[model samples]
Target: MTAETHGDRQLAVRLGELLGPRHPVAAAAVVTPEGTHVASRGTDADADADFDFEIGSVSKAVTGLLYADALTRGEITTDTRLGELLPLGDAPVARVTLRALSTHRSGLPRLPKSAQPWRRTITLWRNGTNPYGETLAQLLLQTRDVPLGTPRSRYSNLGYELLGHALARAATTTYSELVQQRIATPLELDCFYVPVTADELRPTALHGRSRRGRPRQPWTGEGLGPAGGIRASITSMARFTAAILDGSAPGTAALDPVAPVGGGARIGAAWITVQVKGRPITWHNGGTGGFRSWLGLDRNTGTGAVLLSATAASVDRQGFALLAEHSLSTGNSDSNSNSNSNSNSNSNSNRR
Candidate 1:
């Protein structure tokens, strides 16, 4: 058998072991100097590279890229305020800086305060409805009442949502359109996109399930587009990962560590960088009502890995382990590698 084919088989076995038998559907890919290898585990006929999965907050990482690219284009500056672009009259949040928002130090709450968050949560648990279905105007109206706290390093979906829209406003376009023009089209990631509503989802979009196997409605909305509304196929993710590793992706600067985000980790825009097995691995994980995703890159070794699951199960550790293994297999690192246990525990805490 060819060496590459045998390697692919072994990788597939390892992926299966990581996912276990209960996961209904998942797709994984490992990018190395040799090339990219993809694998899947599911019985569904539509489970393949082209099947779209809600990437959740990994969309923030994409926004991080846009943020950096915008900086390069001089469309905005780190000191830019939200009120400068978005029409948030005198809300305290309007004074927050783009840099602070991107690093999650804007003191914005994890989510906008709903008059009945408990009711919303219950509704989500019972019907799998999209709670973040607010439009841009609705989001702005909601932001008008949001009170900001002391700037600190806290993961805030609200911050990214506002940051993305402000950037879009700077470009004189919508957040979805800005992403299409800057990131997807440039990288040729045809299946990567943000759908502002459930009805906008493509027919090939896979239906996700809850942790206990209940089917879920797709999570899509104009307000969530920059934070958790992105959906992409495994094939598009592979291309995106490869582009990030090769510095060909727009806003590649977003991967650089800029501020410490506690636990000995650092943040750059929305991406998190942590030392795993003595190597600095940059990554971001996402979770929604029905889906989970993780993408990690070992830039030092030019290797990366992505994991997408149609169930609400955390896949951060598997992604880290895959990148570590791929790095070792490519003779890019020492053999004393171990998966970063902290990643699985901390990365998915901010579920969308």
Candidate 2:
């Protein structure tokens, strides 16, 4: 084999070894600022590792991006309230702002009580539950125990569902369509979408599991699509990561107008920040019935990669941490531009 081919195989094999082979489903795409792509194991040899995976919460980051795009276009503002955009029943969600929902400070529940827990029994693509509309209906009927602008962070899926719906309303379009027009299409992400049917999912899509260690069928998150329910390939995600790292992806949308979440350095829109060794590792992971995936980018180095797998393996922590360490070391830079932007955003809120 040629040296380049051998080197690629070795990288994939070493990644597999370090993270373990149990990661039944795996796809990775690494990209440099110069626009070079390194496709590793588990990717379809025919494609550019552009295959799609069921990116769980990573979808929220997409939603955040879409919202930012809307703001840039003057479709909405960060202070827009949930109740004003969407017709919430008796719930005071109207007081909840776009910033609150995006940053996880909205005091919304992690998941709505009405969500059917049948994900374990049904196929992931076919899991049935109330659609986004019905989920919002239920939210209107419920009562929130906390006041608006609560400092605590509970990580609510229902909250994002609301944000997605609000964004759709603000854009005067469907949620899926808004995501497509605002982020996916502009970014030239050919393999990403919120598929309505299982057949629409790629064969390489990873599956998620339950706490008992069994595969789950397709499940509907009720009003949580904004928080998750996104599927894309490693190639698409690599571009997505690159856009986030350098704003050089096919799209030119801003990452935020909603601002950095919490006093903690772990979340942006939907992405999470993890400090590996001493460098900041900005990333996010998603697990759904029949699918689990992770994406990470080293902001300091402008380098990133996407890992898509069809298995419920627990190798995410290892694979992401390992790649993060290597990438950070390779592309270390002193730029604090992203951090400074976030810090300025949090200057107004005293809550931790």
Candidate 3:
């Protein structure tokens, strides 16, 4: 292996040191711009590591792809009002557009307000986080307080839920169907699925450990389906992120260049722009009840990795940051070897 290879290995080692030891990781895949296999970990043994796990908010990136494809087909514009797309009532819902929803500038809260009752009950029981239906409905009913067009960087599940609903109306298809048709199908991401069950979920699946110290499986049911319900493999995500960086996805040709968000951190559609040691990196991560996953890409190099685990502890930032930094510093791409390692570092504090 070259120096780059060693660097990637070191990064993997560091991640394992931080996140491993009985942490169930189903699959981990890394890829290069040239489509090289690179490094990896976990089981390539078919059923062992190939099982699917919920990718959570990484659903946003998938949703972004759907909207981009719609925009290209002239089906809708980013500035298209949400009200026009969905029957969001006569309450100035048009003030919120697809663009704001994609970039998370919609000023909506994380979940909808109507979810307070169920959420409170869930929290009390230490169950999973409820989906966005009730919360989104509540917020919609009280839009006056949260006005439109105000750019706030709140991570809004409500925004994505709206996007999902709008996309369904605009495309005349459900959110799950649209994601399959627009993103997964084109990319040949066969392992990706939505609204999966615990049995449908892989045993290597990760569980959610709340900030308040509660452990639960993150399933919000079909009502919250579009917001945080997606499961995919590391190999598939690596290819997906690689396509995003390389401009290979169908609608990428018309995409506005990813703009920097915080400092060198840029966001295009749904991908996060990260600058590690001055190297331009674009990536995204997902965490459901127990499963956590990370997708990192060096846009400049068009190389990246998909790290997925069955444990929340497996997908922390320290593990991913070390992997990214190692990928950059050593110039190696050992993404084929599967296994796992991670530490919950502040590397991606912005999104988490």
List the lowest-lDDT window of 10 residues for candidate 2. 343-352
Native-vs-model 3 lDDT?
0.58
Candidate 2, 186-261: lDDT as tens digits: 7787877775455656665545443334565443433445666677766677767776777754222433223344
- State the lDDT at 332 in candidate 3: 64
What TM-score should be assigned to candidate 2?
Answer: 0.75
* Ten residues in sequence with the least summed lDDT for candidate 1: 1-10
> Judged by TM-score relative to the true structure, which candidate is superior, 1 or 2?
1
Model 1 per-residue lDDT tens digits across residues 1-352: 1111122566667777787755657888889878998776662444333778999989999999999999999999999999999999998889999999999999898777852456667887898776778899988898888899889888888899999999999999999999899989989998999999888898779898888898888888898999999999887899999999998999999999899888888889898898886778899989988899999988887899999989888887677788788887676456654586444233442376
Candidate 3, position 305, lDDT: 66
Candidate 3 local lDDT, residue 333: 51
Q: In lDDT terms, how accurate is model 1?
A: 0.84
Give candidate 3 misplaced runs (Cα > 4 Å): 1-18, 34-49, 117-125, 128-149, 196-215, 218-220, 253-260, 314-319, 322-352
lDDT values of the candidates? Answer: 0.84, 0.58, 0.58
TM-score of 3: 0.75
* Candidate 1 Cα outliers beyond 4 Å, as residue runs: 1-9, 43-49, 332-338, 344-350
Q: How much is 339 displaced in model 3, in angstroms? A: 20
